[model samples]
Target chain A: MTAGIGAAIVILALPAATAALLSVLPSYRLSAAINVASAFVTLLAAVSLLAAAPQPNAYILVDDLNVVFIVLNTFVGFTASVFSATYIAHEIESGRLTPTHLRFYHAMYQFLLLSMNLALIANNIGLMWVAIELATLTTVLMVGLYRTQEAIEAAWKYFILGSVGIALALFGTILVYMAARPVVGEGVQGMLWTSLIAHVPAFDPALLNLAFVFLLLGYGTKVGLAPLHAWLPDAHAEGPTPISAVLSGLLLNVALYAVLRFKLLLDANAFALAPGPLMATLGLISVVFAAFMLYRRRDVKRMFAYSSIEHMGVIVFAFGIGGPLANFAALLHMAMHSLTKSAIFYTVGQVAQVKGTQQIADIRGLTVTHPLLGWSLVFGVFAIVGLPPMGVFMSEFLIVSSTYERAPWLALLLGFGLLVALGALVLRLQGMAFGAPIGSRAPAKASALPIVAHFALVLIAGVYLPPPIVTWFQHVAQLLR
Target chain B: MKGLDFDVAHLLAGGLVLISFMLLYQNRLYALLNVFALQAVVLSLSVAWQAYVQDANHLYVTAAIAFAFKAVIIPLALHRIIAELGIQRDVENVVGVGPTMLAGLALVALSEVVMLRIASEADVLAQEDLAFALSVVLLGMLMMVVRRNAVSMVVGFMSLENGLILAAAGAKGMPLVVEISVAFSVLVALVVIGVFLFRISERFETVDAHALDRFRGDQR
Candidate 1:
């Protein structure tokens, strides 16, 4: 027990301590190294959690549900840091960032990592809220790092909308406490997830229903759902590419994790309204909305941003279906999407750097100019479009099959959206990788290993799933129901 | 609960909603800040009364934070920001006062109906407080939607957070961690928004958020 607790503490503290130290460091290269090193340590600590899951305490816990998220969060965070080290160097060379800005960026990156980890492990709802808010604030600062007019505007929009969403979420959280107080007795115990879920069936159904509505909208904004997703495209488009990668890959999953926890609480109460239909409806809307939005986007990062929303929609819809098979598919889809999307972003970052523009119109003939990056992007788009022999294909196949068996109409909608998105992505890929060479033909300076590493994992998982991963996901899938 | 305790709590919570309406009606930037300051003062009093009634010492800390930060420091800072930006006299309203007030009234009615129906089993005092808090929250959101000025939007957000604190205190025995974090988030939000307000004005020569939309090329 003590060993497990110690590992959890180290996982939480490593990023925070690194963030503090990096803020004062003068060398950009050293800070980047520290950033990646600390992320690696945190990933190790998270892996250690799988050995001996800790008991649910007041503020933190290591359970089957969160261990999956912790491992994914740390792994991607570590890779993103490695990618950032090279990516930020190119930015400095181009005078897009200074050493001073790099200092703040590195620190904010670690803090963002710390907060996401904390949110994942938090057993107390209030603590989770605080951690997510901290993460939002850090990202807001980083999004505005360029200090350009559009960048500042994007960060401001994200700030106001994100903060408002967070406030609504807090109100919902308080309402949950109010609902639990009568059954669980007040003070700290009422806000603890373990305690609240244990007694949720005895709480007021109406209040719980109302609270879930707020939770859905509040966290839904962070999840980048349609209508609440105004800030998402701009944030992804304007921020540094590495930050965009983390935002799409890790932060969205953490917010979804929060919503899932609350959904479990509501599902426990027999009289409470079914939360599944609402999630499914929102998920369907986001998928369709983002798919159409993809056709009009000119910026590479912005297009991928919409793709993230589309994938999140599908994942949420799968979870909404709420059978063991569907739940398992949803969990697998999340991990696969995170890996693939970040890999795509890594490729996109290099493409932008090589061509010196994020505009698709300005760049062309990646196959002729930078063959390594060009084909990697082609592979990423293939994987993201859910082509056969990709992990996303396997999970998306399960989701569609399950939905078809239950709700044929909804499945049709899901299939149509996915098809539209696939068409759009393929069209863009043709333009980006095969047209007449136009922009700067400079080769990318960053390492391609991270992209290769991610794609390799996705491909392996698609072809074959190791027994342990299958069992772990199955255990969590049952727990979700 | 004693009748006086109930009435006092009712008065303060109701005053918060009323002040939110006043915020919606105000047009000039300076006047909006003043109305928001008044709302904060009412919020502090409501929190203090709950602190005493519930005898939760930590609620007093929350009350002090509200009084010092929301009521005094934030308004003064915003006031300076407005004067410095030379937008003190700007009259910025996206929707007219008459319609906005009617909408706010409708929101209050809606919140009352929703809260009273859903919270039928909760204590009477808490039910009343929750209803008023919901109204204030909805009104604050309405203000954000109707106002064009960035500063006005910040005031709207702060007022919405005040509603949250009110709800937190009314739910007797709500943890102190929540209160402190709420207060701290509000402070950080204020500082960040203040900086953005300056940056926005510097670029556009106006604090109206409409300028921001014009800058976004994707917006049709």
Candidate 2:
């Protein structure tokens, strides 16, 4: 199983690496087919990866820590590819994306899958940084594909800030190496997570302490933490919906994965302050900041971009208040969020296509317009806003409960932030999906399969988390602490 | 030879911080790109220095990549972009150079204090690298904040990346895994910038960003 999963990652990624040639050879349609097929295969591969070895290991073994995330990433990537299959067709029809650029786009899309997968499977800190940068760069191109003025500015902003984040992360990776070099010696082995972590105690406490700060700021920015989240909404609102969904649901988790891995290193040192308070503080700030901004979103994509920030804040905060219960909750939130948010984007993209606008005021009363898309949007919002029986509610409850245990005062702030966010999301959604039909109500013909697939996952997760999944998360939560 | 090694690292790292200041001082788009280019050159030197210090030859590739892609290619590309877009005229400064430098100085001091406090028990090299890194990061942010021109703002961001590379290379034998990734990221960045230049030209007639204020959430 482990071997199959490993091979699957290669299979999903190999086509992208080869598509550079195919793109140049003028076989655009074939390139797109290969790209989408491989992304789907990659999703299956990730599932198999989880099935094969759901235990942490010295190099590239799936565990509860990453099983949910890996699966979510591959699934989102697969669905986005499907959406892109249709979305790109429209772009081509409109002459927005030249077939030339479309070829490049598919190649980059596969490369992105490769990068995210590499990051998730990596057992070395440096490899993880490299993987993440690859993913960031791929999205930068895909986002700018429209080459419109706003698209250009958005893509440029994303590249600049994304580079800065990558730089910080690289430095943080180096610092982790510095912290480990003395104890582990100077070689490839020194950079491996299993090796560095095993010898973390003898490493310099001072280096570990400082390194953690850089790591948090660097990776946190990618995760869209406040004060550093300026690049996020712009990137999301401007990029193709597939890119937006992948960025929020998949790439963010990959960045957080880097932080958590380093957190494990710091935990091993026994000198780094629990790192909980700092994470909690940042998480709280992001939650509050994003919540307030959600009310101000004029663009549909931007509103959900802020939502990504808010949910990420909650997840990071849960980890900050780390315990088995909270950690487990954080992991669960991570999974549900990817499913629900991507499902939301699928609906948003389809709506925008049908209406010829993304302006919230223009897109009124989705239910009145198209029941299938409208109802999906409604259910997605309900799931996202933490309505009862949704998995988000379950995870958030645990986060608040854990916060209550640590600093009841912080819990009040967290609760306040969640409520504000809840109000904002539901309020806008109320108008956009349910009010009197506004503007155009014509529905675009597109595949409904991926949207349905994601919603089903969210529903199943909400209703019944498999016993094995629960057991996996519980053990992994303990391991994280 | 070893005697010159760490000193060279220190010099290259210090050069990065100095170039960061130069970034703050620039009021013209051409100057910003040139300074950014210089900064990238220094960054590669620092990376090469680490390769020497740690006997990690893989870092040599990182150094070469930084030199070729960041210092040479990106600067040339941005210069062409600005000139072609008719934005080669002096950039309109929202913040004067004097106060910006002062703010940069304050950021540098804050970084030194923080790095010193946190890494008191760390190796002297790391202590120095962390302080230098924070300053570069802050200056990059300052560039993003103070500059209204899209191109220079990107230059600031690249300078920030240079600082990170310097800091990363200074760590000595960190790993080769991210080395290739960093190269690929630079390539991706260039592609995006290329896409943006052509697209923005078509819409705004010029690439100045102040015009973008019109698109804010609350229309005036």
Candidate achieving the largest DockQ: 1
Q: What is the TM-score of chain A alone in each candidate?
A: 0.99, 0.95
Best by TM-score: 1
Q: lDDT at A433 for candidate 2?
A: 83
Q: What is candidate 2's TM-score for chain A?
A: 0.95
Q: What are the fnat scores of the candidates, in the order listed?
A: 0.48, 0.56
Please give, for residues B1-220, the per-residue lDDT of candidate 1 as tens digits: 9999999999999999889988888877788888888888898899899989988888888888888877888888877777777764665677888999999999999999999999988899899999999999999899888877777777888899889889999998988544444645554555446464544542233666677544543433
**TM-scores for every predicted model:** 0.97, 0.90
Query: Stretches of candidate 2 above 4 Å error?
Result: A1-12, A15-32, A54-61, B1-12, B28-56, B59-63, B66-75, B116-140, B177-196, B199-220
Q: DockQ scores for all the models shown?
A: 0.52, 0.47
lDDT: worst 10-residue window of model 2 chain A: A54-63
Residue A176 of model 2 has an lDDT of: 79
